[model samples]
Target chain A: MIARLLKKNHSTEYEELLEQIAQGQPLPTDELEDETRPMAQAANWLAQRRAALDPRPGYVRASRQRLVARLQARGGKRPWLHRHWGDIAWWQHPLAHLALVMLLVASAFLSASRLAVASRAWLPGDLLYPLKPMAEQAALLASLTKEGDAQLHIEFAHRRLIEAQSLVFENRYEQLPAAVADFDRHVSQAVILVNQMAGDQQDEARSLATELQQALSGQMGMLMLLTNLTPDASQAEFQRLLMISEDGVSDLRNVLTPDGGDAQHQGWKVTPRVSMHWLGEG
Target chain B: MPDRQHADETRLVQQAQKGDVEAFGQLYEFYAPLVFRFLFSHLDDRLDAEDLTEDVFMRVWEALPGFRARGVPFGGYLFRVARNALYDHYRRNRRRSSDAELNLEWEDNFHPDPAESVPMNIEHGELRASLAKLREDYRTVLTLRFLVGLSTEEIAVAMRRSAGAVRVLQHRALLSLRQELERQESEENDRQTFKEEPLNGV
Candidate 1:
């Protein structure tokens, strides 16, 4: 009740006084009735205080110079790389420069890896064919253990078979010879590496060799069909590829079975469905 | 202010962002007094205010690179920095003393224009003493509004309050200040009466 009475009594008078002060108007003595005189006097006192409180000129000048000098000093201490790498003195810190170079090299290798992945579908005569094998070689180099090497070689041989088929379909006869050579090289490398394995790895190597032989037999059948359909000029090349694949299959079976007994009993022979159609006529 | 002057200040801020020390120095010159006034009013100590003013600008220099203007006036942003610096000063110095006296050294330096002088009997020492007794928010709003000449909207921006809230605070500050002055006067009158009664007893 008392607070409400005070607000009702003083709100208008106080508002007018504050407005006058805010507007930089002269406080009115004529309008000051006895009850409002204290407020008027307070407003005038505040105005006088504001006018009297100008910042000393010398202090302002010193603070500005000090702040500017401090800023310039801070700017000067920033590393050259943070400021700009164009400075020749960036090499002054050898480790930092080396780190920068390593970063750039890492970025370039990452980009190349992406490009190589994108080039996976490219055929022998395509612009990105070189990158395909380079990528394969990189994968092979990354895994140089005996089993890993054998597995990668088989993978590359499978890739070569696919490329040879693609070349035959595209009538890219000139590149088929190179593709066949690559296929034979990978299959031979996979068999030789598998044979060199010791005790526990021998069974794993035999299983991988069997899988490789089966893939080769399938490729050989495809080559036989392609040879039959190809014109006379390219028929010999496809026939050669078929022979190379058949020889690869025979070599894998010999490596797996090692005896002259029935290779089918040892489960090293190509399936009947794969070899029967091509071999029966031959 | 004229739009051209505002444009010039904006340009200066942009240059400061790009590590232009001269541009930043220009900003320092223009804002140092206002900042010093704010610190002086808040700290009420000349040396601490001066040191804290320097601290505020040094912070500004370090933080300028990341400071995006958006639509806030540079003055409002600067006062915000000043406010935070004062808060830090208080937090650091709060346990030491509660001396709330304003430095009146500037009174000696004040040279009012001859024509503008209206001689009044208001005792400035008692007025300052009353102002010092006010709540911190009340004193701050009064200083930002009257001493620093910020508009209510600008005070709202600097203080992070609504403009209506700032107006209410300003009114209350004025009322509280007047009431304090009245209290002081009544106490003085009582002291005078006590002294006269003792003389009568004698």
Candidate 2:
């Protein structure tokens, strides 16, 4: 009952107690009926707050000498490469962040370029990468980590396109279209996988990434598939559709005829030539 | 003036507010131990208390020149700034911590034995954990009255309130502290193999 009374009248009772303490009187026995111990708690609170605001005696002096030279320069505009010097009370210059950020970007670029030119990097994972045709495509893999899955797929597709070029030079149309078809299918599959994963989390940025991944994957897939599977000409008839030479002779003549028959002369490899259809300008 | 120290303290505040670093440093040295004791009681970690003490002076140095030379005692203005800074620091750090992390952060380091020298080394952090649990009124009153050694009149000026109001806050703050202490004691009893330990080692 007294506890409830104290709760109801606690604020007034608090004042009465402080007055009593200040006057050097023990809390009245009636007021002490419910709460006699709130005294030290308030004492502690004030003390703690005070301590946090005041540390060692001369810390201000210590920081003054440290900040004096930097303070002089910041009176106008600060130098870009100088220390951040984070004091808003003195310098409210808006250009501070802009200069700092630009310097950061430029220095980062220079450091990356210098390291790229001067550094010799060896990775333990390089030994495992040569086993896959897709893996053989990424020249940048040995140097960095941020290329992500989409870049990896693009690198692989471009590599397969290079391989198709070799087949075109060799007149290997049958194998060339099949390789293009494989690249198309994988890229399309990767696209559908991303599309299936959209709208999952609250992070719109990540969701947008899924959308981009799906769209690019589909575009890449269609490019490969359309070039290989379009029905304008029969698989063998494509041999006469050679854009490499305007004579429109069969690819075998170029490979077998003595005038141009030297397969090793133009760095050409011997293969069937079904790779004539290219959806892209490449 | 040489004898009373109180009159001298007022003079120092006027000089400190005029950008005298030495005057501010004198106030810091005089009040640092008193502040630490209060922080040590409220927070359980000695290091955090020490850090906040340092931070308080750092902020005082920055804000002192702008501080108005109002007729109220300088200690009240100084501690009021310090108190507000503590709350701001808590608010900022709260955003960076998860629920579990906050619980861990707020864990009290006060032991059953007052003589336990280990935790008092970093008294401020430990006290903050306990202080965070208090109601705002209780926190303000308690901090102003006991910790900062503000008279009721001084607290009145800083809080923009009547001395009666500050006294009431002091009372309510103490009640809350008692309740908090009791609740913690019971909770500690329920935990298995729980032993009293100070968070800050001597």
Candidate 3:
């Protein structure tokens, strides 16, 4: 019965006692029942013992100095190349120079490939996310044809659009603008690349433009769905991006049909040339 | 004063997050002793405590960039790190410890504050000794409560328990400690009596 009473009153009375001790308050008159005195006394003794625990000043001072020195040392690091550079004499030996060049190239290739693979899944706001775009740019430069470059740009735009949708879904609104901006840039670049082809690659260029129109059409539907889901503060930006996507899709449809009219106006749905997969679908 | 100190710490944490090593060093200065005392009370070894204190700060420095002060204070985060470091130390050194080491001299080596140079009484000494004999959770609750001066909520965050559970555990721990102190006191009395009775017989 006493234990039950203590448990019932613990939130108020005993808690007040604990709060008072925690605040270093002087104890009040002896109103605590007999069952509580021993615990209160134990608490008092524990508090007193707590006062006795003082870390040696010498240790504290010495450790602080050592830690500051270590922090400074860590902050003052120089580039490894600066430390390893020697006179040009080492470069005079062609074999040594060739081997060093090969080693540098091999290490760079391995590290870049590993970083690209590691950063593949990283989104905006991640430390490795910048590497993802750098890798995509490197891939764009490696493509041998304008059509190939346009396809790569479309692929990158698709990834960024998915990332933007994910940012909205995850409620990371701060990074949403960055992801949307990236998607806009990629889509714009893909359209420009498709428009640049005029001479012998015209047929393929028109086909790529048609594909771009289809993708943008599908993305327009996704963006409209997301606009309703986006928070009020970000709705304006989402609408602006949606308008840009609409304009791009209209411009591509005019270029594809050669009559400056949309596929819907021409009385036929634009069939997707590729796999026709949209974001968030299986 | 506490408000000003908290503001200063918040500013320092922000600067540290931005790669200011000096700001982090200042944080180390503020929290190192508390971390050391907590570690020492748990491990009962001065060297291990100091080493783990340094390790804990190093980790805090590395993890400062990701630390957001969303509801959880930096001190609570730091104590959590210290607890993890203590557990890691135990796992690594489990085979090296034996029961004999628990009785190592604590008061003899305790560096009392120069301003408060009052000598410890017998009860304080006995209490400190008996504290080492309690179970891990009891000792930890008491140490974080009294030595570290954490509130029940902070202790709950550190121990990953609810505030009510912490309160109940603390009450049980204090009762257990009182029992331990009584047991030690009786042992000391019986030993003294045994010594004096021989002289009385003589």
Candidate 4:
């Protein structure tokens, strides 16, 4: 009965023995019962064979040379794009280079135009609507001068006001807060741009500021029309939009005015007013 | 591999992926012999083994961009590439069966000195016969484990089996090999005794 039980557990015991042997531990034949001794011996023999099976040195050397040569030859055959001189060669051909440049510009302009047209009618929840803000940003960034910058920001502010009204018109109250925030940001960005102008650019800044003020006044009137239509779920966001537009109009008024002898407004300078939330804290 | 060597291999693989032929050459130096031996055991033809080993590395170079060091050890990946190349070789040659095609013979061309060459001996023939008698998976497990000196985990990846399964298979294979060798030894001994006994009677 004892021998039978030990024999029954011998397979598990042999697995353990195999693990030890695999780790290069010597087989403990004295401790192992007869059932696993043959397996242990066989494992040792296999390990011995593993030790003896070394490839000839001459073959390894010759094979290495051949492989290295082949690898080098193949590596040399790769196209100019993979070579070190690839960058220089890429722009060396005058006609091909001109064609490549033309192709890239044409593709970029075509894609941008298509995206703009498709996204023009897209509203807050539409799939391509996100591209609208991104395109506005790209346009804003591409403007090299402060006048263009302020103009782009005013245009984007108008777009946001339109988007917000469309959301209200479409009963998309959940999207109103994002549109309000975007409108406030664009308006603030425009105000900051016009205010940062130097003394020499004050006249230009004043002109841009007047255009922005007109745009904001039109947007404010449109926003007030939205108040009656906006639901309670989006009342807080609509109120925030109204406050932003009121502050924007007031700031523009201050920018457009200067006391005849007041030193502070001589250079078309007035400190920017604290926002409504900040005023509430005060 | 130890952590140090594995780290170095990862670095080399990264460089090779960027078309660094010198770094790939170093990798070939380290693994080429083992790969050649692995193919030789199956091909029994040195030139074929050499060609297939080169083919495997070429394929590896082409596929290097997609190789993720985190997925499998470089050694395991190389062997998998070698095994696939070997299968492709057999397929292209219109072989009947892959297992039946294992023509493992000792390379008699191996020479300690240029003036003399070793010849194939009887023990190698017997060993080859013994290996030939084993099942295909059994033969592969033994060749990869013993001849190639792959760790169990590496063998598992190369064979596409679990480490535990490889261990079990290895254990069974060794035991079976031992039984076959002992049976052959017994028959040889019996024949020797019978021939000597006839001489004694004369």
Candidate 5:
């Protein structure tokens, strides 16, 4: 039966000898000389070499004891968590460990998202205020597509402007700088993202640019009012921020109507609620 | 007999995975010789092989916790670790200018019985030298199959190859060794013939 199987499966000369061995038949001497001689010689040489330098029994015992000692030392010093959790049969399952890792990652993401939402209402003086910008940055990172990125930046700019207004109203003078910085960053990011839009998206981009210019013009009017309310030391900084916002509004207007059309005629003029000295007039 | 030993090893592996040091020690006793023979044959140096054998077991101990049977026998896993350790050893040695020198201190640490050492002959030395000349994969397969006494199926698991591939490698390795031996014989005969021929000046 073995010979038949060998004949079917293998076409090698050694198949006959293997079949013979399987059937308890002696290997013919001539067949051995013709086919198996070299292989037998090589196998014999390897076996002799293996036996010649087999590790001494004493060395083997010492090595085994050393390994055991090492393992025991490791086990003794292992942390309580590893010791308790490592041996649990379910914990040893690969899929179980994978699920545990996935659960940890999901919970971490959830906690970060919740923290981000709660941090949005914080003022600069609050501990979580710093997380607000981090949250905005996270939002920007999430909106990687070109289509939504400009809108996301513009939304964040509006949020920052509102935050600046609240900080000014509350007389939180120390927080004003961070709020102004956040507003500036959001406006700049919106401009850059809008400018990066493809030629086919020009009409939508121009509309978004016009909206940003109007929003910045409105925020400048509020900042001018806040500048008057600000103390002498902070007053100059607020005026500087107003000038920067005014310049940003002009840059967006230029991007929208690059051929230099009449501001009112082009419908890009935003009526400033508070009249102030035009920084661009100088 | 092999089936019984494999069953025993599987039980021991399960115990070792649970941090049973004694069971791991028994495993070490059982597998150390097989690993040593494989490394010794490939490296062609007894001391280097022994050191690498110890290193292999150390890694095995560290990794045993994450080891699942996954249809591969424990011996297969152990040898795979041994093979990787040997590869790392070779890579490190390649970066250094000095090859790993035989550690003479090994003899001082453990002395084998005089009777245990097989007397080396010219033919054995030639065969060892030729084996070293074979490609690493060929040498490895041949050592695992013959010197380590692993069956083709076990070698397939250890090497992560099909059993048929292992057989083909074995056959090719044997043929290459035969060719090397024949070439050496022809060269020896040429030298002998030249020596026996009288010089024209003489």
Candidate 6:
């Protein structure tokens, strides 16, 4: 009975055993029942515990080595790097010069990418890239650059600005999640203006245009990052998740509020996560 | 790859740095699964994971010969590559309209039993396939909690966040895992996963 009790329903016993395991106490063999030994899953449990206890590295490379070996075997015939740079060997080769160039190129690319990832990092210098016009679009939207073709210019600039914003977000490229919070605010403000304009608030459009102008005001230290054509990517990315969070909330809200009734978002409340739609359960 | 495997990796890395596509491909085959595992952890969709895995390998191929192999382990370098790729994927995909985000509620057919053909498990050959069906934070936390076994502090280190954040992540991870585990119970074909105490010298 004791063996049966210990073996069959061993969770409590397992707990005690785990404690013993932690203390480095040896579990008694004869005193324990068969079930006390992991029945079918003893292997996986130990593996999980071992993994938890001491994390191993290199399974990552294990996956790569098989293919890498195949790739290398193919390279034995004609080693490109050896062929090209073989004459210059390590000491004579421009490895230093090349590494320097590579580093500079990588650095510039990554920096530009970081900026391109978010509008917040935009600088006077970056404006020289396709991004300058994005800032200028905000001005154009406000008709700040009512160049001979006003409506056409706003439409063109706004479209381009939206495209730039889309490109940044499209990449989901994250450098520092917080860096883009300002950009998110800017994006949201632009969205709100667009929404209002859609609702025919021409007067309110100017306010949005002005908000965008102020948003792009100071370079905010982007000067240094903007000089590079490319840069080494950082470990993490910047994102303006709040805009998405709010967007999620708005999405649920719209679903809750029946369209064509009260146009105001006040008709129904919505949470950031769950969607409480008026539609019946399927 | 094992800790002992770097000598081989070093050979490949040296060749790859020279823009040997074949050498880089070798590196890809070895690291691809780990990259896929982490990618699956970060992103739910398998196709997306596969795509990102390809991207990470391509980036490695592009950047290898110039890559500095010292100071950082090859795994670290691969991880850096995968992380950059994932960030790019997130920027491209997650920012889309909310409609793009599939609902998280359970489907009647996604039963753990293979016979029932769970939509989530359509992909095969990976233990983590179903886990990848989970939400982003939940999937990551579970991967770290179970697969990586980083203590809360360690997890915080991995995520570059505070321990409190890791704790929060753990809580959420457990909740999501519990739900999925229970959902597995709904399947007729659900069989208990295996385990054994393979203690050293035992």
Best by TM-score: 3
Query: Taking the tens digit of each residue's C-alpha lDDT, what string does model 5 give over B46-159?
Result: 577788999998778767766777777777778888987875676456432112332222222333544434343232344456676675567777777666767666776676
* Top-lDDT structure, candidate number: 3
Better of 2 and 5 by DockQ: 5
Better of 4 and 6 by TM-score: 4
TM per prediction: 0.47, 0.39, 0.52, 0.49, 0.50, 0.36
Please provide, for model 5 over A1-282, each residue's C-alpha lDDT reduced to its tens digit, 9 standing for 90 to 100.
Answer: 322322222455664443343233444556464346665555545554555435656778888888889878777234454444442344345665565566456647778667656666687788756456555555555686865778887777777667766777787877776666666666666765665552468788788887777667866667777778877656645754674565456445434754432342446555666423222111
TM-score of 4: 0.49
lDDT of 6 by residue, A152-264 (tens): 33233333323333334444334234334334433434433333352354444444443333222212122122213122232212122332323322322212222321323
Worst 10 residues of 1 chain B by lDDT: B116-125
Per-candidate Cα RMSD to the true structure, in Å, reads: 34.4, 28.0, 23.5, 28.6, 24.7, 18.7
Instruction: Give the per-residue lDDT digits (tens) of candidate 1, residues A1-282.
Output: 323323433366666666677556778888776655665576666766764344654878888888778777777233443444322222344655465556456647678667655665688889857556655665675795988998999878877767776777788888976787687668767866766662367678778877777767766656777778876666656755665565456545434654322343345445423544333322
List model 3 lDDT by residue over A1-282, tens digit each. Answer: 334433633658777786666555655547876667777767766766654455665887788788778867877232343223311123334655565555456648677667655665678988767556656765775799888998998888778777777778878878876777677667766766666663357788788887777777777666777889988766655765674565455435434654323343347553323334764331
lDDT of 4 by residue, B1-202 (tens): 1132554888888998787887888788778877876776565545667778888887777777656666677888788778768756764553432446544444454446544223222333444567777765676777777666677778867765545446645755776787887988899999999989979998
- The fnat scores of all predictions, in order, read 0.35, 0.15, 0.32, 0.21, 0.29, 0.07
DockQ-based ranking = 3, 1, 5, 6, 4, 2
Local distance difference test, each candidate: 0.64, 0.45, 0.67, 0.64, 0.63, 0.42
Please, what are the lDDT tens digits per residue for candidate 3 over residues B1-202? 0222554888898887776877877788778877886886666455677888999987777666667676667777788778878866764665443223654454344435534443543333454567778856687788777667777877766765445546766876787788887887899999999999979998
CA-RMSD of model 4: 28.6
CA error at residue A198 for candidate 6, angstroms: 50
Which candidate achieves the best DockQ against the true structure?
3
lDDT of 2 by residue, B11-56 (tens): 7877755546556556765665655544444443445666666667
Measured against the true two-chain complex, the DockQ scores of the candidates, in the order shown, are 0.13, 0.07, 0.14, 0.09, 0.13, 0.10
Error of 3 at A152 (Å): 42
**In candidate 4, what are the lDDT values of residues A205-251, reduced to their tens digit?**
78887777666665555566567677655655665677677556544
